[model samples]
Target: MNGSKISFLAFGELVVRQLTDFSNNAFAALILLIQDARTPMAVSSGGDDIMQSHES
Candidate 1:
C-alpha cells in the first residue's frame, strides 16, 4: 500500500512537470508529450541519461 502511494505521488509530480514543460508547446507538439507520459520515465532512457537530448 505504501509503495503504491509513493508511486502515485511520483506519477503526479511527473504529470505536473509535463504540463509545465508543455504549456508553451503547440497542440500538435503536445501529442508526443502525452504519449511519452505513458511510458515509465526511469526506463525511458537506457538508464544512463535522465534528461532528453536536444540538437538546438
Candidate 2:
C-alpha cells in the first residue's frame, strides 16, 4: 500500500432535521423520552443478529 495513493471515506446520511432539533432536547430528556416510548426497545451491539449478519 502506498501512503500517497491512499484515501478514505466516511460515508453516511446526515440527519439534518434531527441535528437541528437536537438543541431543544437535552441528553437526560432524550433518555427519558426513549425510555417512556411505547415501542419495543433493544440496544444493538455491533452487527445485527446472527441470521442477518451471516446472510450479508
lDDT of 2 by residue, 1-56 (tens): 45433432211123555665675577768886687564333334333465467788
Clashes in predicted model 2:
0
The sequence of per-residue lDDT tens digits that candidate 1 reaches over residues 1-56 is 99999999999999998997778576757777776666646445653253444322
**Model 1 residue 17 lDDT score:** 89
Record all residue pairs in model 1 with backbone atoms less than 3 Å apart, i.e. clashing: none
TM-score of model 1 relative to the true fold?
0.42
Predict model 2's lDDT versus the native. 0.52
TM-score of each: 0.42, 0.23
lDDT of each: 0.71, 0.52
Error of 2 at 2 (Å): 50
